[model samples]
Each structure stands twice: as structure tokens, then as C-alpha cells.
Target: MKEELLKTFGAQFETPLIEEISTVGKLAEVPAGETIMDIGNYVRAIPLLLSGAIKVLREDDEGDELLLYYLEQGETCSVTMTCCMGQTKSEIRAITETEVLLVMVPVQKMEEWMAKYKGWRNYIFESYHNRLNELLLTVDNIAFKNMDQRLVEYLKKKSEVTKDNCIRNTHQQIAYDLHTSRVVVSRLLKRLEKLKKLELHRNHIQILEL
Candidate 1:
């Protein structure tokens, strides 16, 4: 665990900070599609991604979900950090996008490290800034972009995060992430196919132009 932690975060974190994380953080491996955190759940820890990716999502009262952003290796969720600091329930859900390896740092350590480590403080602030930008981008896409354009951007993001041009999520799953109907997603996907942007398969999508 220490070696993995160092390999993932050593460049960004001070030696002492890395040592502290290795000593106190719990290593976890989660499979793809597993929900690591959910709305209304009290956050006990913040995750530091070591490998793979996790997608953070927001949910409405109607139970509809929209993907906020993806956290890849060496990234942490700022929203989760906020919840930990406030001792509040999570407003978003975090799910594994692929098999993931991460280190879970207890909530208390978050504050402790902020005061003790400059690297930790910088990391926390940077996480917040990056996440805010992503949230704004999501809003812009929904408000200004067409459904097809949003879908194409979403696929491009997914492909980038998973490091694969072939997307394995179903149309319905993509609909849930985009906060739209499966029928709508399917229709848009077919349109994209005809436009030579992507090729739709029975269970996966192969990116072409996107």
C-alpha cells in the first residue's frame, strides 16, 4: 500500500505527507459499476485514486442522475472533501467507471493534513477548483449544447477517462448519466452513427469521429 501510494502521489505530495497517508489510509479496490458513495450517505472518508476512474454524479428529487465529472488516477473528489469537512451527508454519488484502486483517508485526517502539509492544502484547493470548473462545464453543456452534442462530449470524456475508444455502457446507462430517456439516447446514438461520429453495437459503442 505504501509503495502504491508513493507511486501514485509521491510527485505531488511531500515525503512526510506520503508517509502519513500510507500509515493511516486504507487501501481499497472496487469493481466497475459499483456505487462507492450515494446521496444522503454520510461521508466517512475521501478517496485518492491510484488507478482506474470514478464518476461522480448528482441526483434530483425524482431520482434522476446526471454525471458531474470523472476522477482519474491521482485525483480526489472535492465534493466529498466538502462533505467530510461539514460532517454532512453526501449530495452526490460516486461510482467506479472501471476496476479501481484507491486509498481512503479518514475524514479527520483531511483537516489535520490541511494544517500540517502545504502539499495537502494545495491539493485540496486544486481539487475544489477543478471540480467547480467541471460542474460549470456540465451546466454549460446542458443549457447551451444540443443533446447530440452533449452525448458526443460525454462519450469523448468517458473514452478519455477509461483510456479506451470503445465504450461498454449500454444506451440506458448512458441515458441515466445524461439525465435523459433511453429512447432519446437510442435515437441520438443512431443519428450519430449516420453522421459517422460513432458506431453503435449491441452492448458497446465504438468511437469514430468522436
Candidate 2:
């Protein structure tokens, strides 16, 4: 399972590295509403989110949390990568329960792998490229799309093909996903709910009609 999860990083590298990683790292189960890692906390590894959901958030000067979409199953967390790369301090947190397969690559191991395996380097680069593309698309959406359109489009895109249903992403989270204020999201969600298009439950917002 770990091997296949890492395979999503790229097709070039051998999945056997997951076994090697297992020797050096460990698996963690984070319960609902738990903080897997906090902003400004330094961690020296990359985590493959094996199950459940995690959110990336940025806090405002007033100490309010802004939702930054989520890192869903099969998707690795960006804060983990940034920390591993020794970049700026992370400003994100896990917003939901999650299970992660952690891989810690020391400096020596990084150098050795880069020297010994071209495929390994290709795999890492590819993962970064894909992340950049996701970021770019996000930026483009925020710049060009209206709030209603963006929110509806995000729901449509994330909905399951079978029933066109998606996980109950919260209003605040949707506001963050749209890069808008939660008050706006609240108003919009109220409007959507009134239209009989969605239903709200404790900590969850379900789309009732596509």
C-alpha cells in the first residue's frame, strides 16, 4: 500500500523505496480536528496522506483562520515538502482527521539517492512540477472567476462521478478555497441552502443537488 501511494509521485522511481522509508520513518493516525503539524513548526520529512483529509490554512493578523482548500487522499501535503526543502516556515495546518506515511530523507540520503538514481530525481521533480501546476490553476481561478462561479465550479469538479456528490466541505473552508471572506460564504451558502441545492450538518456541508 505504501509502495503504491508513493508511485503516484511518478512512474520513474521504483516503489521499493517505500520499504526503505518504512525502516526510517513511521505511520501516524491523526484523529478528527487534530493538528498534524502547526504553522512555523519545522519538520524534516515528507508525508504521504494515505487516508482522510487535511487542510492548508493561513491565519490572519487578527488570528482568524482562513481555509486553503485541502490535501485529500492520495495527495501529499505541501507544508511537508516546504519544510523538507528548508524553505520558509509553514503557515498551514491539518484541518481534518488523517493517516500519513512519513518519509524522512536525511541530507546524506538525498545526495546518495540523487547520485545513484536518475529516476529518483525525475520523480521528485515531477511531483514538484505537478504541485506548481495545481498552484497556478488556483491562482488563475482566483484572478478570473467570480465567487459564485468559483464555488459552484469547485463543487462540480470535486463531486464524485457516480452520484455527483462531494465531501461536506465547510463554509469557511469554501471561503478559503475561493479566497473570499467567510461572511460572504455564509451568505452564499444560506442562499444555496434556500434554493434546496445543499444541506448543512454539524461541521459538514452537503450538496443535495448537483
Candidate 3:
């Protein structure tokens, strides 16, 4: 499985760092829709995706949730980094959006590698910057954008992220992600369809102009 690590990021880190990862990292294959991390729970490892994607979400105490972002191939979850750096539980949750293959570095090794290796330090910093921007964008959408515009942009992003113009999701699923009612989502989708922006079937949405 060490080869899998190299395959994901070949020669990007020094040989010593690579060897450390090889020795300490564990490979995991997660099925689509499975929760990898949970709210208020401690995260023990920082995962580096080798393939597929993970959806990151933030949930409140009352069980209300918001779609935060998605981590795809070659990306690490910054929330994991935060858990590693301090004594803290996960504030957000991560669920596999598709069958996922990832290498998990134990929290100890994650902290050690950050201090011991330059490449690992850079990687952690980059992950932090990227995820921070994603969270900010989510906030901007919620605070400023209208639900219809947000829904359209969300669909466009979903299509781009999955690399499929035909999105395989139900109206209820979309509503849940957008923090809106299913009836509202259905109405917006119908409006988009009528405007020639997209076509919707039972569970598939085909982008025509978006």
C-alpha cells in the first residue's frame, strides 16, 4: 500500500517523509455515503485521498446541517489537521460521496511529520488555506446570495466536481444540502427547467445551458 501513497504523490516529499508515511499510514477503502468523520467526535487520523471524493458538512446541535465543501483526489481534510494540532473534536463531518480510497496518517504521525518535514508542513498549510477559502465561500453564499442563485451555482459545482453534467441526486437531497425545503427546491428546479437551463428526470439532472 506504500506504493499507493507514492502513486498519489510521487516524489513530492523527501524519501524520509515518504518512508515515515509508508511505515505509519494505513490504507482504507470507504463506500459511498459512509460517514468518515462525525460532529463532536475526535478524529484520529488525517486522510489523504487517493481516489473518489468526500463531502464535508457542518452540523449544529439541533441536527441542522450545512454543506461545507468537498474533498476530491489528492486533497486532505483541513478539519483533520485542526484536530491533530490541538486537543479538539471534529466540528464538521465528512462522508464519502463516491467509493473512496485514502491513506490515513495517525494523528501523532501527522503532527510529527509537520515539524519534521518541509513537504509535509507545506501540504498541511495548503490544505488549511484551501479549506478556509471554501468555508468562506459557503458563508458568502448563505449570507448574500439568494436561494435560487445558490441552488443554480450548487448544481453547476456538483456537475463540475463529479465531472458529470447529469447529476444523480434527488430533490430532497438537494434541498438538504441547500438548507431549504424540498418544495422550494422542486420549484427552483422546475423554474430552471422551464428557462432551458437544465432538464430533470426522476433523480437525474442534465445540464443544458449551465
Cα RMSD for candidates in order: 0.9, 4.0, 1.4
My TM-score estimates for the predictions, one after another, are 0.97, 0.72, 0.94
- Tell me the TM-score of model 3: 0.94
In model 3, pairs of residues that clash are none
Candidate 1: tens digits of C-alpha lDDT, residues 100-185: 99999999999889999999999999999999999999999999998988998999999999999999999989999999999999
Candidate 2 stretches with Cα past 4 Å from truth are: 1-12, 64-66, 97-111, 154-179, 194-196, 200-204
Cα misplacement distance, residue 65 of candidate 2 (Å) = 4.0
Model 2 local distance difference test score: 0.62
Query: Top model by TM-score, which number?
Result: 1
State the lDDT of candidate 2 residue by residue for 1-210, as single tens digits: 456446554355555555555565556666666776687777655666556666566677766664445666555664566566675566766555343333434433554565777766665576567667766776777788877767776676556321336455677766765667889888877787899888867876788884
TM-score of 1: 0.97
Tens digit of per-residue lDDT, candidate 3, span 26-84: 88999989998998888888899999888898876778777999998889998878886
